[model samples]
Target: MHEMSITQGIIDICEQHAGGRRVLSLDVEIGELSSVVPDAVEFCFEACSRGTLLEGARLNILRIPGRGHCLDCGTDTPLTAAFGSCSRCGGYRVTIETGEEMRVREIEVDE
Candidate 1:
């Protein structure tokens, strides 16, 4: 899957910031609506990190819940999918507030 490439990207970011230091752990954020599977990423991390600074690094995945604001009902509700209906009025006019993010949040490196 694409997680291999994504894992490589994570390693690249860690190496860039680690400055040749060995990475001990990493914190990554994955949104519910982002469609990037955390398990897949975790599975790929080991294979992708081999021979890199993140080889033995522990990966911590933070799952973000999806949220949306309904324009018709003026209500904020939890969303489970990309094109989800509003909970209040069951309206389709909804704007996403969060849960579309995928990024590396923190990195711990060995001194």
Candidate 2:
């Protein structure tokens, strides 16, 4: 699954920022529209982190809701998908403002 690759990327980022210190925990932000499975990422993290600096690191995921602005109605609305219709106007002309993000928010390292 893509979560395997995504987990590897997370490990890479943690290692890069760890600076030889062992990672104790990681705070990750995954948007609802990012298509990245949180469970899969958690499972992959255990697999990918084996024998690595992040072997026992705790993974905390923050799920962000999808949001967009309706161009036709000029109103901000919550979106469930990438191309969701505007809630206010029921129009397809919506500009997504967020919800396609996957980033490492914080990394806690051993002293």
Best by TM-score: 2
- Estimated TM-score per prediction? 0.96, 0.97
Worst ten in a row by lDDT for model 1: 1-10
Best by the lDDT measure: 2
Candidate 1 lands at a TM-score of 0.96
lDDT per residue, candidate 2, 1-111, as tens digits?
789989999999999999999999999999998999999999999889999999999999999999999999899999999999999889999988889989999999999
Question: CA shift at 67, candidate 2, in angstroms?
Answer: 0.3
TM-score (C-alpha) between model 2 and the true structure: 0.97
- Candidate 1 residue lDDT tens string, 38-102: 99999999788989989889999999999999999899989999999999899989899999988
C-alpha local distance difference test of each model = 0.93, 0.94
Candidate 2 residue runs with Cα over 4 Å from true position: none
Query: Relative to the unseen true structure, what is the C-alpha lDDT of residue 8 in candidate 1, on a scale of 0 to 100?
Result: 86
